[model samples]
Target: MTVLLTGLPSAGKTSLATAARAALLAAGHRVEVLDGDVVRRELWPELGLSPEDRERNLTRIGSVALLLARNGIITIVAAIAPYAHSRAALRAAHAGVPFAEVHVATPVEVCRRRDVKGLYARQARGEITGLTGVDAVYEEPLTPDLRIDTTLEDVGESAARLVDFILHGPVLSSPHGGRECSGRF
Candidate 1:
């Protein structure tokens, strides 16, 4: 299975992925996290933040995720994934595999305040441009498998919900706290 956690920078996607990974590991499931910033810095440093560049980057990440999933590893991806078309293409490519696109729906103001990587601050200082959800375009997902707002719940609660979805299947929830689970474990 492949789970893509898409959101703005510092929107808690990486932190959530880390917590969920730990929980899944503790439950004895083999899992791998492909964090976008780490992957870009370590592997694809040549790639820029342009739309085409972002699409190429995500395609590469999706390829690796698919490979891991085929080998029986659960892959969790934490990425900005600003383009809706790119995300849809990745999902379509998964075909028979279980693929879940999870929108980390934290507001931009909250993310700017968190600023875990100082991205927002740098943007503010004019040291950067094309920052996703700021100057750049982040085409939000219209209908994701799940939508999580970091402000609504703590990381532990969010991680538990994600782990449950991974171990079982889709756990649908509304922004206001209603939940409905479906599919087999």
Candidate 2:
């Protein structure tokens, strides 16, 4: 299964991914997180933050996620993935795999306030270009498998909710299929 987590900068995408990875690992699942920042820094160091570079980066990550999922490895991807078309293409490319899109819907104002890296401030001062939710637009997910509003939920709660979603399926039941459940937050 491949869980593609999308959101604006500082929306807790990486935090949720890390927590989910830890929870999944504790549950005996083979899990890995492909974080966009880490990937950009490590794997595709030459890729800039331009539109073309974003596409190339996403393509590489999507391909890697597809490959890992096909081999029964649970892959969690934390990326901005600002373009709807590109995300749709990624979904199509991973057809037949258990792919879940999780949108971490955090407001731009909140993200800017929590900007640990000062990315939003940099963009405001003209020090950075192509920053999502600032200069560049982030195409919000129309219909995501899971949607977490970070403003309303803490990171631990959100991560646990996502873990529950993945383990019990979209309907929110027990992983062992013991009883049907409902009312997932």
Candidate 3:
């Protein structure tokens, strides 16, 4: 199973992924969180925030995620993934796996205000280029499996809901797995 959490910067994707990883571990599930920031700094150090670079980064992450899922590991990905086409490609690449897309639907204003990493501020000051939801574009997910409104829900609540969703299957599906996934968050 792979849970891909996507949103703009400061949208709590990392926090949610961390919480979900901890909860899944407590439930005796082998979970791994592949965070974008850490990946950018450590693995893809030469990659900048250009559109092509971002797509390359996502491709690398998606490849790792698919591999982990194939090996029965619950992979949690926390990435901005600002392009809808790339996200769709990822879903297609990992078809038939228990893939869930979680959109951290935090408002841009709120995110800018809570810019813990100062990304939004830096973009405002022209110090950072190609910032999602700021100088660059973030193509919002149109049919995400889970759309968490971070402005309304806290980290623990969001994590709990995600855990429930993962453990019990989609909220619209039955315990026997007889139904197709149809519900949206």
Identify the candidate with maximal lDDT.
Answer: 1
**lDDT digits (tens) for residues 63-109 of candidate 3:** 99889989989999999999989888887788777787777888899
Residue pairs in clash, model 2: none
What TM-score does model 3 achieve against the real structure? 0.90
**Candidate 3 — number of clashing residue pairs?**
0
Error of 2 at 159 (Å): 0.3
The parts of candidate 1 lying over 4 Å away from their true place are: 171-185
TM-score of each: 0.91, 0.90, 0.90
Using TM-score as the measure, the top candidate is: 1
Could you tell me which 10 consecutive residues in candidate 3 have the lowest summed lDDT?
173-182
> Candidate 1: lDDT of 184?
12
How many clashing residue pairs appear in each of the predictions shown?
A: 0, 0, 0
Q: For model 3, what is the error of residue 136's alpha carbon versus the real structure, in angstroms, after optimal superposition?
A: 0.4
lDDT of 2 at 93: 81
